[model samples]
Target chain A: MSNLLTYISVNDGKIKRSSLEVLSRCNEIAEKNGKTSSAIVISDDCSTIVENLKSYGPSVIYTIEDPIFKNHLNTPLLKALTLAMSEINPDVMAFASTEGSKDILGALAANRNAAALADVSEFDWTGDAVTAKRPVMASKIISSVETKGSPVILTVRSGSYDTVEKSGESKVQSIPFTFDKNELKLTLKEIISATGDKVDLSEAETVIAAGRGVKDEEGRKLIDELAAVLNAGIGASRALTESGDYDPSLQIGQTGKVVSPQLYIAVGISGAIQHVAGMANSKVIVAINKDPDAPIFEIADYGLVGDLYKILPPFIDELKKIKG
Target chain B: MKFYVCIKQVPDVNAPLQIKEGELIQDANRNILNAYDASAVEEALVLKEAHGGEIEVVLIGPDKASETIRKALAMGADSGSHILTEGSEEFDSFSYAKILAEFFKDKEYQYIFCGKQSQDTDSGLTGSMLAEFLDLPYATNAVGLQLEGENLIVKRQGDTGQEMIELPAPSLVTCSNDMNDPRIPSLKGIMQSKRKPVNTIAVSDLKNGLTNGSIKTSVVGYEEKPKREPGKKYEGEPDEIAKEVAQLLDSAENVI
Candidate 1:
């Protein structure tokens, strides 16, 4: 029996980086436990995805290519995954902490009467049980937890685990598509991107965040230009969103979405403590604020103390040249 | 129609965290209901206002959680059920869902609701897990919800965009922040909430006895994140700084 199993999620015919992270984490857990790791991908066509997944190094890769999965609804995918897991019966199962993944993982755990941890930022297998750590109280306190029972389910927080290179080959196994479609109680009518087909802030590699310093619509337009050049998701601090310059949906603070991207550039932001709590885990932080005493500079990898209006145009131009 | 909403009390996000004796201490300031749960309560109220229905808010927490439930009651929830428990720090999503399912299996409700996620654990697992435990279809991160005939249509925020999905009646949904503006309780509503029936159930009354050992998950303690040291700071011409920033992001960071 495989000791570790990871559910690899694919969107728009591509595997998300966070899914690979969960796979990498499973490999780590498997190695520590001296057992083999397995992976499962539910997609319409997983040939390319399975091929790409090899770099993460699982002992076996199982693909259930069913037309029913095209809808992106949870029940069909859950049924497929639950069935596969019932047969594999791995000691541990890991899922990426996305909306879809969380929905299915929770139910799957209940179905199997297994212990489940959600959005675990830190996890370790202690030979007898699995231990996990997650942030609580608005990321102020890190809560440590331990789980009991075989086949413990875990939802790994996105961007928390580092993705590593695979050391060996993995065997590909295509599982047969078998599910009663009539049992699906949910229907996916449509999926429309909110940002005009732009990447979501949580999944973006680069994020351009605005604060109160970007006072008006003109300033916001400049921020958008830079975001477009970088292909970055646009984020706003509570101050900007509250002032009606941006939507509350774009707010990033203690009360809003927490994002950990490869690069987070704070434009004209003072870096309130609440704002920093959300993106402090980012791999790199760049702060631009006229106020030299802005708290954002304290955690910034690169700090520029100057008027963002004068700085951003040149910054955008430089980025354009670099991209070209 | 009938609706069930899940509520949780969490530490105020605005309050400063204090570390005492190598352990995290709760802020003495007023504890507030989870923001998402407040949104969930508001969503349930909106539905109740449109269609004649009963709304009941459920919570599994310490005695103090009843205060959170009362807050929901003031917000127009008709009744409340508080499952009193101690040493619940280790109760994970699976165990928590099972308890709610056991409570709900006997009852017939048209819809179930919960916050997209709690600000405390931020796991966002309870609603979906409870639906699974109850053998019902569900959606998460829902910003918009409408009941059309026997089916429920919902708009959920996805990784890339918004998704429109329909689930059969007796389904579950989790409310995101922008679902609706939560209404402040009026003086009359607050007074009415005091008289609202808040049924309290002991943890042992549920299927699984409430204890850290009986639960599938257990907590150790909270640890603080390591502080980030200040990095390189540059102050000068925008053009020069921009060029240097681009070069460093490209060559050194490789994130450009």
Candidate 2:
């Protein structure tokens, strides 16, 4: 029996794609270590979610049903997870690098006195310990880290792996968890999604981002038209958003949203390291700029060095043809 | 009320990285305050202004770490503390959080703020780990913060959406982007920082929870990312370039 536990969180009664990726990765690691992989799903109800997780091939599913979980509050959830970790004592615990998982893993690392790695993209089990790799310095460098002890926690970056095909009928066990009223100090008031733009930049498959090179409102409309033609999400560089011309929520840079879309089209951007940090992991990058020396071209799989004004119209036409 | 903000000095990410001895070392001349921590300092200053509290910025790095705290003070923080670790050695997030928890154990503070993660390490572990070690409630990725009487409300950005949460005092918050635009140091504020004193403490002076060989993780090596091969460069008439790009996208790139 392998002691590998994956933390699964349900939002609005649905399993997050990132969480499923974590479970799938956990199964891979457990299989490599010749151990059984288990999962802990926290939600108001687990009957449906448990069915979904069993397809991922977990050996056992631990279900915790509590109304407080619906709010995504951290304190009570941390309390229950800590108690659950003690019961399992898994050699390795993997969590998705989602906001909730990061918070919980950070707290759980301290609560359980376990070493933790955040946003780890690669990992393997060795003779006595686990070694993982994570990007540093805006992914310009990768660091190899080795954990010496068991019960090491890792937050897996999204898109690092695929969720496995559903298989195996896993046994289910309901974990009894109680939250003390005094201990539950935080209250989740609401969940407000960014409006107007329906495509969440972080989750979009294809993204067309505008930079300061777009120049003005008129220029931005062309970029927007291109995005609409391609049916891709619109993103902005830090400079464009800071100029007060675009919404800050659309900004994609080191300090802004980190997106790993399948295709990222950067227009009029110089390819600063800060901006690249957010989108460097894209499957393919295309940069269109007037300056031939723009750094974005260095990493782009395809480079179109010319005036976007001259290039965008024809580019839009080509995209429309493809769509049609 | 007393508020503590933790800041770090990171290499300006825009500068080209320099590799030495199988590790990526940032250019010393281009170091600046970490982006996320700058947001944390701004959040602390905003909350201090609204709640009538004293703001103290803290750092746990080399003696040069005081430079980051000075930047925070120039941004309107009241004071600074530098926990100078020996040489350039760095600790993992868990050990670093333990040190912060220990340093603040004897101090009086209602709220502690930190960046969601450092730009160099990109590990969003310290804030919540510090909260756990200090036995306090915590929140991460706070984009909006509001104070109501003795209670606190924080709006955090999640993968799917944003969550607004309410918490009492004695909590820790890790700030993210969209929290607020960090104010550049004013000339007057810079002059005041010159006179402000920064208390420096050696790491050995404090009771850290980590013992010899207690750290469970270490960076064994580093590798520079391979540069991408320069792809086809098309420079021609707008229509011709567009057609070539379209054909490439369809046949070569397969993105279309």
Give lDDT per model, in order: 0.82, 0.82
- CAPRI quality of model 2: medium
Query: Please, what are the lDDT tens digits per residue for candidate 1 over residues A138-181?
Result: 67678888887777888877788878868798999887877676
How many angstroms is residue B77 displaced in model 1 relative to the true structure, after the best TM-score fit?
1.8
lDDT accuracy of residue A148 in candidate 1: 77
What DockQ was computed for model 2? 0.65
Pairs in steric clash, model 1: none
**Can you tell me the CAPRI class of model 1?**
medium
The segments of candidate 2 whose C-alpha lies over 4 angstroms from its true place after superposition are A9-13, A180-182, A195-200, A213-231, A240-250, A306-310
TM-score of chain B of each: 0.87, 0.92
Give the per-residue lDDT of model 2 (tens digit) for A1-324. 447788886656767677788888778877776777899888877899988787887889998888777667788888888888888788888887766787687888888888888888887764368789998888888899998676788988777777786577899999888876777767778987553545656567789999989998779989879878777888889888768676666778776667788889999999888899888888888889988888888888878889889888988888888878
Predicted model 2 interface RMSD: 2.1
> Which portions of model 1 miss their true places by more than 4 Å?
A195-204, A211-217, A228-233, A236-258, A268-275, A290-295, A305-307, A319-324, B20-22, B86-90, B208-214, B231-256
Residue-level lDDT tens digits of model 2 in B36-90: 9999889888888877989999899887767788888899999888988988666
